[model samples]
Target: MTSETALPTPASPLDLGETLTFERDGAIGILTLDRAAKRNALDDATITRLGEFFAAVPEGIRAVVLTTAGEHFCAGLDLSEMTDRDAVSGLHHSRRWHATMNAIAESAIPVIAVLQGAVIGGGLELASAAHLRVAEDSAYFALPEGKRGLFVGGGASVRVPRLIGLTRVQDMMLTGRSFDAVDAETIGLVNYRVPAGAGTAKARELAAAIASNSEVTNYAITQALPRIVESGRDEGYMMESLMAAVAQSSTEAKALMRDFLDGTGPKVRK
Candidate 1:
């Protein structure tokens, strides 16, 4: 797991509405899937709620820790909602999922998914949307859409591939293959792997560190960096230099630099 400092419980929970709960601990927000009965499977209401909530993440929350109740993190979309939909409706549904996933990924604040058992189908897509993922030993990932005679609707087709690569995603989808936490980590699906039930704590720790970052730095990473990667080499370098100038010009940057130069700030250490 990534190194992080521990924090106490949040002061109070925020009212983010049903199917989920929200709490703020300093600059970090804890967004939890509260649907244990369905193993946190996301129906339309839940998915819409998830998107809406994150799209307007509280100003006080600079980073997020996404977790769920029960053993399983999410079983994917509530397949029960698959009843009676024409091809056009299905297309719209898929697009809706795409929008939901995109909202999370596009947020300026970093999101960290705390993954546990049964991270499958749309569950995997949801995890992929996170900037970082912490997987517990009990966590297992899969793409069972093939067996269900359906293709992935969420942005997994695009985002997951970027993380674990297209070939591996193809292999998993084609064979309905499942990967454990360690394997997921090795494949780049998860940033950190921890013992069972330790995912949330570790993820929150990461969130705390992320929250401590300068606002401009975090915004650049969440916004400019990904776009820069997709640009041509010359364009990417130009973008990087522009961002570097803006970042260094910040008052926060000046203060931090002074601290480092004066030996007040923490130094790099193994």
Candidate 2:
């Protein structure tokens, strides 16, 4: 797939200016944080652009890769915008982030995050929303909300805990501890760790492989796996069985099975 497909530029009536870049690589949608001067720190405008980009993702897209064009993936939210905010205002502000991030998480296509350099605070929260995460050697993860006398305003308090243990997250916040890519992978924060500068390519390759799957299978995998994990074993098994029956009964699945039996499908190779 060509990597130069044009995507809609961020254009809002409010005109917050473009702090994000959206592009399409064949069936893969690419969203890049463009605020390099601030280490891609998400300000109100950036957040708005992010919401707009994800909300309007093209229907033809099959998957998405979230990355940034900078040494740092993201340093977190712009605290400059947080000054003098009252309780009601703070809750709404945080809710805005939740809405934006949830759009990414709940998109029709799965999202893969490509991380490098500093991924801290709200940055980590964003990455956690993706279905898969690939971190480069240069990437580091941290949660410094405690040091800033603030709590996690993004969905980190919920999503991140599902990745790494609550204790590890608390330690990162409480003691300002940082974890490198390898450690992050070990702790389940990232699915893969590759050499620096290779994260986006790797993520694209992964997304491409995922895009080749049957649409129904991909949809079920993305939508049902998380719910199954959250359910009790008995209920989860019932749901899994139901999904399995539905998936295998698809015409695509039957065609694939016929190809395999007819020796038309590619043989397994190491």
Candidate 3:
């Protein structure tokens, strides 16, 4: 194989642009949806770049935070480009979106979404892919495709149901029910709710905590836990035990245990 093919494709930060931006804060990687003039509406380039960024997170980055500029987090797809696709083109386009969503959701590093304003339609679908979501009180959630005479094609049909419930999602679609941040939290769509303009701070805090965790522990939680939850009881239990054993046997785990036993580690206190 050629040297280029033998080595993995490296991911570099894309140019600072209206569509998207990338920056790093210590061990945490920050991804920003920058098209606030359009409420950060995603076009094909933005979606593809998102997949590339998440898929090839640098080795030093332990966690990721996804946030956006302006009042809104993301408005959704760039409907201006939502024209001119035949059925086959539409299928391929939707499949590309699925691939990107999966890349983000199954990323090696845990991801936190900092959300605000209108997280509508495809925006909601994008947020659903994160491991943790910090929602500002101003944030709103909706699935308006039913009104658009369209349907979700960005892994929403699968991932959203896993985050919330099938019936609730059904209601959102059929009735065009919009959810406030509080309602989103109540229904398990978001993990944290903060005052408007504080979503990024909260997400950074969560990402720091996640980054501090043992690598194996974080990996297991981010990767294995979901699959375990979806598996049969017997299979889940087996996989759970396997993950537990692997994590406990790591060198970092041994050191952590020693610290705790020696009373040098922080104790559990509330």
| Candidate 1 lDDT, 193-251, residue by residue in tens | 99997888899889988887788899899999999989999999999999999999998
**Clash pairs (backbone) in predicted model 1:** none
Worst 10-residue lDDT window, candidate 1: 1-10
Residue 8 lDDT, candidate 2, scale 0-100: 27
Q: What is candidate 3's lDDT per residue for 1-270, written digit by digit as tens?
A: 332112223346454345677788999888888888899888987887787777677768999999998999888889898698888778777887877788788887999999999999889989998889999999999999999999998888999998889999999999999999999999999999999888888888988988877889989998999999999999999999999999999987888888999999767888
* lDDT at 189, model 1: 93
Give candidate 3 regions above 4 Å deviation.
1-18
lDDT of 2 by residue, 189-260 (tens): 999999999999999999998876667788788788888999999999999999999999999888888888
Candidate 2 lDDT at 92 equals 76
| Position 88, candidate 2: lDDT | 81
